[model samples]
Target chain A: MSLDAPTDHTGLRVMGAEECLERLASVPVGRIAFTGNGKVAILPVHHVVKGVDVCFRTSGGSKIEAAADHASVGFEVDSYDPSTRSGWSVTVSGIATVVDDDGLVVELEASDPTPWTMGDRSREVWIRIRTDELSGRELTRT
Target chain B: MSLDAPTDHTGLRVMGAEECLERLASVPVGRIAFTGNGKVAILPVHHVVKGVDVCFRTSGGSKIEAAADHASVGFEVDSYDPSTRSGWSVTVSGIATVVDDDGLVVELEASDPTPWTMGDRSREVWIRIRTDELSGRELTRT
Candidate 1:
């Protein structure tokens, strides 16, 4: 562990896969980063950990369009406390695809992932981010 | 305010530039999204708003490298309350560059932006994100 690698420092701990999922599942709101209109855009969404996949709901907008386009996406949920300088952030990097299958959509909707904007529940599109690249970091006082 | 446009809805309000910056300046920590290694990466960092430029510190790593690479970056600051089902998110979509000028670095450091992981202040590289495409959305009950 070199000094240049801060993750190797005593104050910061690199979280394992299980911890990452736990932190993610604990939060209902997370941000999604995607490339749209030739620029990167990040927006907040409500997500639920359905099995190993992080799922969210989006209506007719860039998010749904990103899903329809199957764009490369990054989903992140984080918590930070400036006074204590302690926090945890989990990021899921993968592709966003729309779930159109009626059976799957019905099942995913059963989980009732709240869309940030909150609109017609039946009109919402289910976007599932399936990825193996799950990483997180926890910060603590040295 | 059409049915297709969710922003014009009764609950969600599109924030102006002034409000966006205010939301950003009020928060000490924000997440940055950038493209590195052919993938979009989002990480949380302590930030300070310097006029139109939002700045943060990073050591010799992917973040600094992203600055060196002059990457297209997106910075987001948000707050959400699930109980009220309300939240506000501000996003800055722009390019990230390194502030290597000694005079400027010293001046920026005078503000004393605490890096997420407390490290040697002098050793950390300052990354400035400049963007005109600032947008935000505030969500409340309908």
Candidate 2:
């Protein structure tokens, strides 16, 4: 917290893992970062938090391919209010793997994860991110 | 384009680099994805479009270290409106390097890049991402 800003002007708080996970669950969309084609990539997707896993559906594409390759990934969800100059961001670092367990896939489908994008995504492949570490921070104008 | 949704229900468009750069300029914040400690990391930063480069200021931490190590990075900015289920995202893949030129650093300071977080970041290091490739996609409900 070596911030140069006046202490009275703002506050910075490090949130606990449980609180971070809770914030993640409250958001429907987040960006997933992974390595693909020798480059790091960040793409937005709709995700569902189930137990300790974060799952998202991706049509067989670069993202899915990267997941199948077992890329280390980061998933982030955040919200900011411009007028208030305040926001919180949560990031989960983990290994992303394609979901192939038929029963678990069925369970996820039954849970009704929304793609929220135009496309025939109903039959898209599922990828689950097994969380390894979670960290979050909040910035607020005091 | 392997969408399962009806073609009439949505429209997808690929934007040229110029258009993508335009969208990038309009946004103030984006997520930078890079490899850190053999794991993918994504962190949000306030950035400004500078010529053909994207510039941001980061406190000397993991991100700066990653840049110093010359890791390939992905910088992404996007806007999504839930009401319409539509948005466009632009991703820039490039090598991130620390800005060592004092004159350029002073110019950036005049440009006023916002860190939007807490800390004594005014004298923090500056990182410039030299874009090697730029791509963007738009999803709209027709």
Best by lDDT: 2
| Model 1, CA-based lDDT | 0.78
Docking class of 1: medium
B1-142: candidate 2 lDDT, tens digit per residue: 4455323223457777888899999877788888877888888887888887898877766455455556689889888887776778898989899889999998998897455766566547788998999988888766
Best by DockQ: 1
lDDT of 1 by residue, B107-138 (tens): 88789745567555446688989886898888
- lDDT (Cα, tens digit) per residue for candidate 1, span A99-121: 77889887877777445565665
lDDT of 2 at B16: 75
Deviation (Å) of A97 in candidate 2: 0.8
Off by over 4 Å in 2: A1-11, A120-123, B1-11
Q: A1-142 in candidate 2: lDDT tens per residue? A: 3455323212457777788889999877889988877888888887889887799877766455455567789988888876676788899998888898999998998886456755556547789999999988787776
